[model samples]
Target: MNTLAHGFADGPGPGPWILFVPLMWALVVGGGLFLLRRAGWRGRAPWQQGRAALGEQSPIVVLGRRFAAGEID
Candidate 1:
């Protein structure tokens, strides 16, 4: 009684390996975005007092000075 009606056709196909391709792509893209953000750290960060020569204050410090000058309150 070798019948295809009740045979291997009912068995499960390949398993979780099919999910790896998109997972790898997502990891690669996420790491790329992280590095891109990290690369901009120098430009966005304020120059420290120890590092500044001409006395370049950070954006936050500049804002504080303006506030002290009655710009905000």
Candidate 2:
């Protein structure tokens, strides 16, 4: 019989080893996210980065807002 009651009538199959799939996936995803954060991904928004890169005098930003407001073509 299956140790964790997860097999069929043909005796035990993978038993509890099937749980390793999810555990391994969790570790992989969590590790990837942690490494990404350590590599300088502090979750800053796109607009924040754009403003910091171009400063307050950027014409593209003003033009983008004007386009959104339909002020000019």
Candidate 3:
């Protein structure tokens, strides 16, 4: 008999292996983000990098440069 069919027929499958999905997702995603940032991928690439490179600059930095340039009061 197929063990998977029997298990699901019983209910909820079985052991804690269900938790592996989220764990694996976190490992893949978090590890990728960490590696990207560590390698200075932030604000460097257009597609391969993350949000820090997407031209989403903070207001403070923009304002600072504007003030220095006498563009704003």
Q: Estimate each model's TM-score.
A: 0.39, 0.46, 0.41
Model 1, 1-73: lDDT tens per residue?
4343333554554345556778999999999888977877444445453445545565667888899899887
Q: Which ten residues in a row have the lowest lDDT in candidate 1?
A: 1-10
Give the per-residue lDDT digits (tens) of candidate 2, residues 1-73.
2365565556657766688889999999999999988987779975666676776578887888899999998
| lDDT winner | 2
Could you tally the backbone clashes for each prediction? Answer: 0, 0, 0
The 10-residue segment of model 2 with minimum total lDDT is 1-10
TM-score, prediction 3: 0.41
Best by TM-score: 2
Better of 1 and 2 by lDDT: 2
Residue pairs with backbone overlap in model 1? none
How well does model 1 score by local distance difference test? Answer: 0.66
Q: Which stretches of candidate 2 lie over 4 Å from their true place?
A: 1-10, 50-73
Error of 3 at 53 (Å): 18
| Residue 67 lDDT, candidate 2, scale 0-100 | 90
- Candidate 3 regions exceeding 4 Å error are 1-12, 44-73
The lDDT, on a scale of 0 to 1, for candidate 3 is 0.70
